[model samples]
Target: MAEHKDYYALEMKIDQMIDELQGLCSQNGLSNTAAEEVVVTSVFLYKFLSDKYMHNIEKFAEEIGESVDEVLANENDELDAFYDAYPTDVVFHSTDTIQALINKSGQPGFAAMFDDTLERISNYQENDKFKVSTAGGEKEPLFTRITENIIDKSKRDAFAVAIFGIISESKFDFSDAFGGNFDFYSTIFEYLIKNYNVASGTYAEYFTPQSVSSIISKILVGMSQVDDNKLYDVLDCAAGSGSLVLHLANELGHGKFGNRARVYAQDVSTKSTRFLRLNMMLNGLTESLDNIVQGDSLTSPSQYNVNHDPSSGYKKFDYITINPPFKMDFSATRDEIESNWQDTDRFFAGVPKIPKKKKESMAIYLLFIQNVLWALKDNGRAAIVCPTGFLTAQSRIEKKIRQRLIDENWLKGVVSMPSNIFANTGTNVSVLFIDKTKGDDDKVILIDASKLGEKRKEGKNQRTVLRDNEINQIIDTFINQKAEDDFSVLVSTKDIKKKNYSFSAGQYFEVKIEYVEMTEDEFNQKLSGYVSDISRLWNEGHQMEAEIKKDLGGLIYERK
Candidate 1:
């Protein structure tokens, strides 16, 4: 599999390149290390795109209805020269104007060259006919926020030279490395996010541990029947770096959905959108890049409206998934959401109460849950990562959401996962599966997987790592609606209602109590032993008290 490729080598090379870039940035007085990383990585992406273009020259030419050599002859002479001497340290000359500016090798020159090069490669203004769609998007260029002043001109040349050397001679061919499988790229991106070579954020915003994504993806795909002719629209309303959506796309897209499964990703973070689009490109899912939107998913969802109507907006999606921000202070936008989307169907459960102070703990997940319900088409299934408390909380909104899921019969099941499943947060989480199609089905599968993970510490925070077998077991039990003792149970909606709409597996699972039987003689012997031990301790306590008194008597009193 492509995932087993020598990704370590690529990681090592990228690390080495980043070290050089950072060293140059530090020397050049670039205080904003985060911006430096972003700009440099953006340049690296462009280099990869350019290199991929060169390596696949024949294919690209054919797609554009041109002869390969003819197309190559018309390409930028400097890029062509650099490609010719690639994989070697041979010095190459470039006739391109950007190269001329860089040759000046000063602050202004480097900035000018950097700006021109990025625009030429990404914006494709230099040659409109030959454009890499990755960079020519309607949204602002991914690195538009990167200003030329980020690094000094002298440092810019060093950065440029280091980046050029790394890209030109590197053995990593992203296309060949990816080999049509995105998992390897996804892992590499995760590694980058960890190393802080990508956007700056809490790691949780960029990564959903593969174990979690794996479980969600497997369960979601297993529960849904894929139709080869149907285009499954997979959405991650809070798609942090696009891990969940990409996993779903890779897993479900290959089966009956084929390439027909389009991905819709939205995140409120601009940095997240950048990482997400790069993830999609790395996975060769650049076709769906446009669907990755940057905006507040709650108040201003940029994709198809969650509240879709026949007369106006796009159709509802076939599948929806999200691991939304567990808690956020949406007080700023609360008025807008409440005033505009007052329909009970939107925030059907109830809006989280606006706390006057310290509103960061507001239960945004409830609203996301409602959004998922609205976004999904009839018969659609959604697997959402939620705080485990949501399943059992007596809070008004929390209970209302659970009750509605039960009464409306939208909930398929709830898997109570172990605490620290997410390394970034300690909140115990659960994967709530809601199937609109299964509304008529009374049984709701509740699995207590809270104890199923291998307990381990990840840095300061603890996490539960679910093995492949355990993941599969959870999926199987839920999909087959199998009720096992102490592990999972299939409870009817009636039973759930009786339990006050509590989806907690513990609430329904029968607790078994075991007792050991003993004869009269055995009980008497055990009782006697306990009595003797207690008597001995009593005597010892008296003797210790006497010894303390004697020791005090030995001390001389110094009276003032």
Candidate 2:
């Protein structure tokens, strides 16, 4: 629990490594930032595997039926050539091997090496000696994305040297950081997405900030803990890079939860889906890699099935967490969804109308909400991130959704967060908690945390950052259903309905009227000012009347 010194140091080294590669690519003919990102992330993975192998090389050697020296000296190199070609100590020894390979075969050769390395790493199976998981097999290997058309010798060499230097850095030690329960690799994955350009396709995988994810994860896990023996099936329909689900997995029980609880995630981005598999493997939930699927969660609801009953076709989960895409074009598949799911109640609130222009801002989050509601089990609970306007907006869909929550008694609480909680977008967001297990509790807890974040500059934009204590406070207040002045309020469902299905805490918060007792001297001073003003007005009126009388007397002769 102490400061993650080594973790932060490792992250810095990776950043330095990225900068080194960027510099090299600039000097070379290659300037594609996307390619550089892939190279940097791939290098990190290589180093991660190298460290794992180095930790247990003797065991690995015994399993391969080779001596340590022979294994160290590139023995029968059929599988994992990178591991065979370079010994544990010499893998990152120098860029000599890589440079030689590049000289012999050029950029295509280097790209192939990366492709093979990544493929081996992803497909590597779990063994008793080393319980490791692979990440790149579900999609086209990352190396294939790089081609000779865009790469040349100088670019290849620069990437190789930069990666070798980074892996060789003295500060990059996983033993120290991974000694405890700290997740160093997951942090590294976050850094990869944070610093680099993973925004290539039609829909970029935007990760939810750790602060927000932590709060939602903690609350959902905490609420779901009411019955630990009951296996809780958790799902995130729109699991971007799988950060939200990973955090939930970490909070729930790590590998322990992997056995009893089933984690499901679906994303439309193939690239992000692969990234998600890597994230799960890195977190020690090697079993969870298969649970993550690649496809549009809305249209392809195959994995959303809870009991795995094709007869029901629709699934339910004990717990769900999602930060779905804000605005996306589901128009191509919208009608099909409407027609098929019309009777399913998933779109009972009403589907968003596809606009003629700028179809990007369509209300995709609403569909996700309805899906969560349908997928949630009878006693299930869900934590979802949505636009703040969704809470109080009088739109037909928004109102109907709110009304359903209140009427069905599934509404738990709404935490109104500050603007810019998500650094990439300016739209303010809130976490809507739903619990279907309510025992006739008509009151819904609403916590206005809009003023709770610490203001900080993240790049060119300002973001509201919430510390752990603040996040815990929000959860605590909601769990205990406390109504603190100006911070949280517990409102009845009838009142919420009366207010036109508004779930905003600020609207229901009691306005305190404070009366200040006036001292005798202060009262006299105020009265004295009023008296002086009245006297001045009376004198002015008399002076004007006298002036008019004098003017009339003087003008009488002239009028005659």
Candidate 3:
């Protein structure tokens, strides 16, 4: 109970900080735009890093029987040696400390000083791994000159000052929260990006809800037989903000196992990559920061080794999770992918053809599905979020993919999620699980959880939120392969092939017909009532037909 109260207090403080920062943006005329999001998130991150740096120093001081003030008073060489010995995830210089910045807040050119400090910290040599790399071989640092976004140079100073004031007043201490579970940090991450994740452009950013992420992680990890002593690699090809992959890491015993899993993620959105980096740091997965690549996973997958004698392109992973963009206008790169990737066999199921109209409606998720299949090892496991329509698709790339899964006996199971599960879009979705270790005789578990969540109004849309018990129920059923009447079914690959490779649970469920016993006298009475009603209806129809004929015959035709 005390732990819950402490977490609630931290949540309130974080929420207050975000609200104040956004309000400051409004006062400075940078509200509800890309600039506002960048400035607010960056400033918030600066404060977090500052607090975390101080927390580390405090802990180190206690371990060595030294005061924090003594450590802060150390010269450049002494401080560098201390950091080298301690080996913290983030490095902070004496001049880059928040106290130094606070002392200089009243000085002239304070805004420039602030921007310079953030830039220096981002460009520090020790922090090189934190930089996100693009497909063009360019690295993006953590922070930019965010104050420049304010058009009025005069207000820039006030803007920076107000941001510092808000952060200092709130005094965020993430020390206790870091020891908390994934739910604690996930809540903060979601709240941080809720406003920016709404509808954007052709590439709409779909942040997978926590319920869906939890279900995927729980089932994927629960069903797999993992070795506690071994280190594993996990990937999320279309990781938006890293929620799915983070949950999977936690399930794999992240903190307890001491970096037991290395998380590799790639996404096409720069904004999402930034958010993903923050999430990794917040969750104590700092070792995986170098694996976070910001590029088009389809056109140029950067998570491969090219330095070996024979380049091992598209590194295979032990586990994979994906929530790819359902549809996008990849028409620009469709031809490039076809011409370049033919030898790789990455798109074994083939790509969606460009339509004459509405090219944006092309099903790009098919490519992601095929990519996941190619990236998995012989005994690997994966879970993918797909449109519900993909389950029952009878032809084209969708059917071909399902056919491959069934023919190879790699399909594990599928769960149909509730409608409006994602508050941003109303399209229903399903999770497709794959396990390469399954044999031909293994039956697939199909669950229809579409009717399990409660409906609630979220902003302008109605969202279906799954309760804790409902999520647990779905996970338990899938992991144990339990077949419930009308809700779930366990089917063999032979039966799946007979059904034209459809993965929908409803198709496999039995259509039960109830029979009742009755006496001969009761049956006769029921038959007589049915015959009388039919006879009366037939007589009424004949009378109506005669009346219609007479009315038509009495009418006279006239031309005007």
Candidate 3 minimal-lDDT segment of 10 residues: 305-314
lDDT of 3 by residue, 165-277 (tens): 88773476566665676788888888888888756531226478888999999899898777878787899989979999999998888445587789999999888888888
Per-residue lDDT over 1-560 for candidate 1, one digit per residue giving the tens place of the 0 to 100 score:
13444666665665565566556556566635667657656755665565455555555566667776675567575346444543221111232222344355445455456566566444543233122122223354644434454534445556655445444544344544535446667656675556452233334657888877877888888887777777778889888788888888877765453476688888877677777877776776765765766777787666774345666454477788788888889888887887778854778767887898889888888899999988888878888999887877898888887888888898888888888777777788889988888746798899999888798875555778888799889878887889999999888999999888888899898878998799999999999999999999999999999999887777744331
State the C-alpha lDDT per candidate: 0.70, 0.69, 0.85
Distance from true position, residue 287, model 1, in Å? 1.9
Each candidate's TM vs. the true structure? 0.80, 0.78, 0.94
Runs of candidate 3 with Cα error greater than 4 angstroms are 1-3, 76-78, 85-88, 169-172, 201-204, 255-257, 306-313, 540-560
lDDT of 2: 0.69
Q: Which candidate number maximizes TM-score? A: 3
Could you give candidate 2's per-residue lDDT for residues 289-311 as a string of tens digits? 45666777777775754357586
How far in Å is the alpha carbon of 26 misplaced in model 3?
Answer: 1.1
TM-score of 3: 0.94
Q: Pairing residues by index, what is the TM-score of model 2? A: 0.78
Pairs that collide in candidate 3 are: none
Among all candidates shown, the one with the greatest lDDT: 3
